[model samples]
Target: MEGHKLGRAPNFTGACIVMFGVNLGWILLLLFAVYGLVAAIFLGLVVNHWVSWLEHRKQLADQRYGDVSGDT
Candidate 1:
């Protein structure tokens, strides 16, 4: 049998730091995804409400003043 050569153990601190960095990267990515989804939903809702409000205002204006279109 060949004699086994002993080697120094790997650096535990470096390994731990690398693992922590990987985990932190994943966590940050997940948080950003959630934040983006929420922001998109909020923006969509605001735009929807704004469009509806504008339509309502236009309707009210039309009712108050007959179609000003000279085509009449």
Candidate 2:
């Protein structure tokens, strides 16, 4: 019997490169998403604390001035 040459192996380098790029893109996107979420949470907390502080100041002012009707 004569030896025969088999078909060349499939070239997967291009596919691998594309998959790598896609994976990197997804990883970066997820990182930014998490950062945005954390930033939003911190911003909300800061805003809430500021508003509460202002309200507390107003209450103290009212108590000091005896303005219970909230007109002042």
**Candidate number with greatest TM-score:** 1
Model 1 bad stretches (over 4 Å): 1-34, 70-72
Every model's TM-score: 0.47, 0.46
Error of 1 at 72 (Å): 10
RMSD of 1: 26.2
State the lDDT of candidate 1 residue by residue for 1-72, as single tens digits: 369888898758878879976975675567568787676566556766987999898778777997685534
lDDT by residue for model 2 over 1-72, one digit each (tens)? Answer: 268868799979899979976975675567568787676566556766987999999889888988877555
Clash statistics: count for each candidate: 0, 0
Q: How accurate is candidate 1 locally (lDDT)?
A: 0.73
